[model samples]
Target chain A: MSLSDQELKHLARLARIHVEENELNALKDQLGRVFKLIDALQAVDTKGIEPLSHSLSLSQPLREDKVTEIDSRESYQAIAPQVEKGLYIVPKVIE
Target chain B: MDISSLSVKKIKQLIDSKALSAFELAGLYLQRIEKLNPELNAFITVDADKTLAQAKQLDQAIWQGESRPLMGVPLAHKDIFCAKGWLTTCGSKMLANFVAPYDAHVVEAFNRSGTITLGKTNMDEFAMGSSNETSYFGAVKNPWNLGKVPGGSSGGSAAAVAARLAPLATATDTGGSIRQPAALCGVSGLKPTYGNVSRYGMIAYASSLDQGGLMAVSAEDIAYGMNSLVGHDERDSTSVKRAEEDFTSQLNNPLKGLRIGLPEEFFKEGVDTDVAQAVEQAIQELEKLGAVRVPLKLPNTSLSVPVYYVLAPAEASSNLSRFDGVRYGHRTKDYRNLIELYEKTRAEGFGAEVKRRILTGTYVLSRGYYDAYYLQAQRVRRLILQDYLNAFEHCDVILGPSTPSVAFGFNEKTSDPVSMYLSDIFTISVNLAGLPGLSIPVGFGREHLPVGLQLIGPHFAEAKLLNVAHQYQLVSDWHQQLPAGIAQV
Candidate 1:
């Protein structure tokens, strides 16, 4: 499948990347090549096969519901690029 | 003593015998980092003071006769792991200044084992590129040849261990990130069965495929690290709670009755002739040691690259959404609205390769195209997994060249991303199948570059994988061959 220039731009926007006009053509070409390579999957008949999500078929172990507090919050917030009043600060969304 | 060249086992012995203090070893590694890291670009942050303090505390514990399994062994972690107080950038500009508040589960496990933290090693931005070129900090030069690329996302860790900068370094694999570079750099790297190591603190690449592993001088060291890293963790939903087995116990065992499957697809067209020669020689050595080469077919092997591209990016696009400018990473200096801020911040934070992946991922996962792309990729992934199960029925382990070729010259495949992606053709299927796979230095390729032979085992079969790799290392001197300057150091 070919990606239109508009579709590529929309993807870049959604991905939060700035793709220059020149680079878009290169990306388009690369994406096309990659998609073409992946298209080989279409030939395989997977009608009866179960699509595996995790590698193992093990069930999640059940445990009693419990809550414990580990006070590493102060230490954890210490590395944030920006923090304010014990909260990770971001530009106002509602305002 | 130059402790950098010592194996993890030897380091443990020294620490236990009181011949070397953990503090001394940590100091020596810190000194090496100071001296060699400038040229290698192997580290993003070197927490010298913190490391020294931890080593001192471990030394005190050793004095009290408190013995831990990996006590006093100095090791470095890939920057992708979140270590409290250390910058955990995953080699991306978006998280460049992001300091992790808590340690990843792997980091906690190492800390519990009293392993000294040397520092955080460099990697490709968000673990995207095969070469370290995609790192936002800068490209990591191969310790073997400065002009060549160190196989990457875990390139810095592999190069660091190769340069004797550290005895052990933590790494991760999604699509050949751990094993490919390990092979190219002539070291040992293992990606345990998925869920073997908890992904709690590892920054997500493709959540389904990403797994924590290690890069060391030998498979034995990988086994030791695996023993410590693997086990069920409640915090990580995907972690498997399997019975813990000693991964290194079978290192001395002969491979006489071992069935080693050699897939024809891996040796088919697209594999470099030089790499094939090295792998063939390694296989010959294994055969001499009693391994019977059985022909196996992973019929869907050719489709691995395409399937992985779709799935890895689809997951990456979603995982990376957390990196929007407003939350915990680089933010745009000026923006009129929230949307613009998000765009500007992400654009500035992520590098070219990362941006390309995110865009591609978003496109694939978008509305109206999910079935055509994302869902189809998942189905293909199952077919790939089935191919491995079918092979395992006939053979105990599968063997192949880790990459199509050894370490290429810097910027060799950068212009052609498709060619670069093909480098992972041999390694991606292991992840697809959720099986344990490892890369060990088998021999040298063109220009004396390292060639890695990949060993793939069935699910939760890390012990066997380690045993086979360790047995190979015993009879071969390839793992002992260090890069020129690394040996001198």
Candidate 2:
């Protein structure tokens, strides 16, 4: 159940985290132990068991087709890292 | 007399009787927070101005002849809940400067009932850790002994209530976050059934497992909060549509012929003898109250830790992905590209324990491991729930130790993640079962630290659990025992 450095980096990328060189081995060791612990679940025979997604049996409740919220763009945008004219400013991804 | 010593009901009664004003009561708690919070580090944010304003509003309402169950009672909220105009950090560096623009459903419920906000208590980063040590704000000390860790991520709330800084505080349990701390700090906490309380605006740790609850001196206090806290919200789709219940109304339900199932698995290996003895004595007290003990077995108990780690983190990976640099919370000052911006902001923002979980979550839910780990854990979760249902056929409630041991000092289990995960062994199965579980201070354990006796009930059976807890509380003095230093404060 040992995770390779390459796999750790792959996980870090998928997780949107940058694993520094020094932190990689430590992260690998810690995650390896957790996976080992998780291995205990493998012994159970869950052949026909239905996966429980949520505790409740209800479907997602739908609301009326109307906007119920008051406009609060100013308040929300006030906390954004970078904003201009109420638009969130992020790095340009495409030309 | 300090108002912090009174019960939630007592406080409301005095306010109703004109013996105390909401403003004055709020002032007393605020002064205590100002004086003692430096040593305890329980509160992350306490706004005297806003709290006083809330109390003044309640004062005006009282003057206008309005009466609410929680009126004029001062309380703290876990940092995990969003309250507009207050810093809701969730004990992480990421959201340290994040002032919520809205109130969570639980916060709104309290506000509607006229509860004055004392402050937001500290928690583990995004409610991820068992020990409160992982908070970016630094660890919260157990009020009983300064060197020990308060069980977390609701440690701040537990500590505050234990020290009588506030009468009660709002808490949430993903995997025993509420109950574990309640046990460690000698208070009562209840994690209601999934969907019993709306999760709207409660910062999600694991969307499927996280349920908001309360920590207080007694089950009666919890019922007082539950009256306002429970309701179906269209905003939160999972909010149960069940009929309303007066949780306090069932406090005196006779336990003459009640059935209490003792889950043999909960007291198996790894539980400290002292903790088990304390739990045994507490249950024996229930037996004296005429509860017939029924031995039950939840065979898949050991798998709960592994199952929860897989499922909770998988949900968290999806939930926390929204915390990219662009929106609210911390952002990277230096990054060349959008990908780098996302990576670095999160890398710097989240603490170690949160990153570990996010990474673990990402790993299990990643393309190849999905079926083997994530789906398997979900299947195991169902089996675990089935275990509780099967056990409940023979009994009305289950009793066990809330934690394996009492509070441990800082750095005791920090080096190994699995050891830390094992602390919630006895309590985790309840969350996986989606049952209502509560922790009540039963007696003192080794090191003179408090031990909690856990009582779990069928889903949405909060009133039953509360009634059982209240019956025990009526005869026990453990919940009434505050940390020695609290009296001087």
Candidate 3:
């Protein structure tokens, strides 16, 4: 199963990665080999088996509705690339 | 004195008897790291002043008559875990400058038990590669052979423990990361049941399959480390809430009448001849100690590598989406729009293997292929788990070679992705089944590198798995053998 250049670009866009033009052939080749391994799963007859999402059956534990965390905006924002007035500064998506 | 060969238990005894001060012990390990780490590339970060300060505080507490279980013991935290006031790089350029404001649950628990932090060990970038070659910091070399690659993404942790840079180190396994590296570097490693250890603040790889575990010189040392490492954390909902267990409590359990399952598929053609022979010899030793071997078949075991690639990548694609350069980690300095910011930051941040997984993950979970790839892999995952459920009914524990072959030289399998993925074939099924698995040095394989024997148990049976491994270590000297030239360090 070989991935076309158009399909490879679509995957990179969906994954939010910038794939260089030179890197495209190598990436396509690597993915082709990986897909060959993954394609083996298609042959297995899993007609009635339940898809196991997690290995153990665990329910999300509930906590009381009270606020549990102390405010640490300053500590958290200190590591952000761009922050102003305790708010993260991202590129203007609205504009 | 040459305390590098001492186990965690012996270190604690020396500290308790006042023969060694906590501050002095910290200095001894720091000097070793200074001398050997330059060549081994084992440690990514080592903070001498902070480590000595913590050691000094522990000495004061001990002087004031306070007691701690693992007092003054030095440990290395894998770079994937978030250690407060330390750079938690996760071996990726994205997190290269990220200083964690909080400690991971494992780090917190270890710190509370009075284990002084030696540093964060290097790892495969985002714990993705089978060999340590993917690390941005540089590949960690196997202590046994300088030209060979240490199995990864916990390669640095395994190498550190093997070189005796630190007596014990913490590592995580998403698909045999801990076990493979431990096997190649000649140490004991335990990957607990999926929910047995808390994942809070542990950098996500594949959430369902990723689990935090330990690495040390001996199985008995691992038991001592486990006493301080396991606990339920409300922070991680998947952290199993259970009664406290003293993992060291059962080390003396005899192997008399023990049922060890030897799966027919594990000993078949793919495994190297030497690895299989060493594991077979180790199992024979167990039989001599009164263990009965039961032959069994996990027919679906062959499909584990394919199933893991699909499921793990799917989960990782979703988990790693958080690294978009907005709140924390590396951000692009040159970007015009929001979308370009995400793409370019990640493009520069992640290495080839991580990007490969992210892209593969995106493809499988995408609109048209989701049902064919993701769902099918999950369904097959159940069949794999069911195989283990049936096998355990006939045997108390399953034994096999931890890896197909001993550690390979660098670039040997890195050029081909599938070949690298197949090296983890023997160990991935346990993660899929959420069972506890252990890798202990049984003997040497080809090239005179270490071969590890894996013991798999039912869910939350870490105590049993460690007990089984301890029984072997009691009769074997493989775990005690150090890298030839490093013994004098």
Question: Best by lDDT, which number?
Answer: 3
Residue-level lDDT of model 3, residues A56-95, one tens digit each, is 9889999999998899889999999999988899889895
Score residue B308 of candidate 2 by CA lDDT.
93
Per-residue lDDT of B321 in model 1: 90
Candidate 1: tens digits of C-alpha lDDT, residues B1-489: 865569998988899999989988888888888988999999999988999999999999999999999999988999999998788899988888888888999999999988999999999999999999999999898999999999898999999999988889999999999999898889999998998899998999999999999999999998888778888898888888778778888788788899999999999998889999999999999999899999978888888888888899889999989887654778888887777877888878888778777877887888987877788888888888988998999999999999998898888898877788988989998998889899999999899999999999998887888889888888898998878877777
lDDT of 2 by residue, B142-192 (tens): 999999999998999999999889998999999999999999999999999
Q: Model 3: runs farther than 4 Å from truth?
A: none
Question: Which CAPRI level is candidate 2?
Answer: high
Instruction: Evaluate every candidate with DockQ and list the scores.
Output: 0.60, 0.86, 0.90
How far in Å is the alpha carbon of A25 misplaced in model 2? 0.9
Ten-residue region with minimum lDDT total, candidate 2 chain B: B1-10
The models' CA-based lDDT, in order, is: 0.87, 0.92, 0.94
Docking class of 1: medium
Q: For model 1, report DockQ.
A: 0.60
Model 2 alpha-carbon drift over 4 Å, by segment: none
Q: Which candidate wins on DockQ?
A: 3
In model 2, state the lDDT of residue B314. Answer: 91
Question: How many clashes does each candidate structure show, in the order listed?
Answer: 2, 0, 0
TM-score of 3: 0.99
Full ranking by lDDT:
3, 2, 1
- As a whole number from 0 to 100, the lDDT of residue A89 in candidate 2 is 87
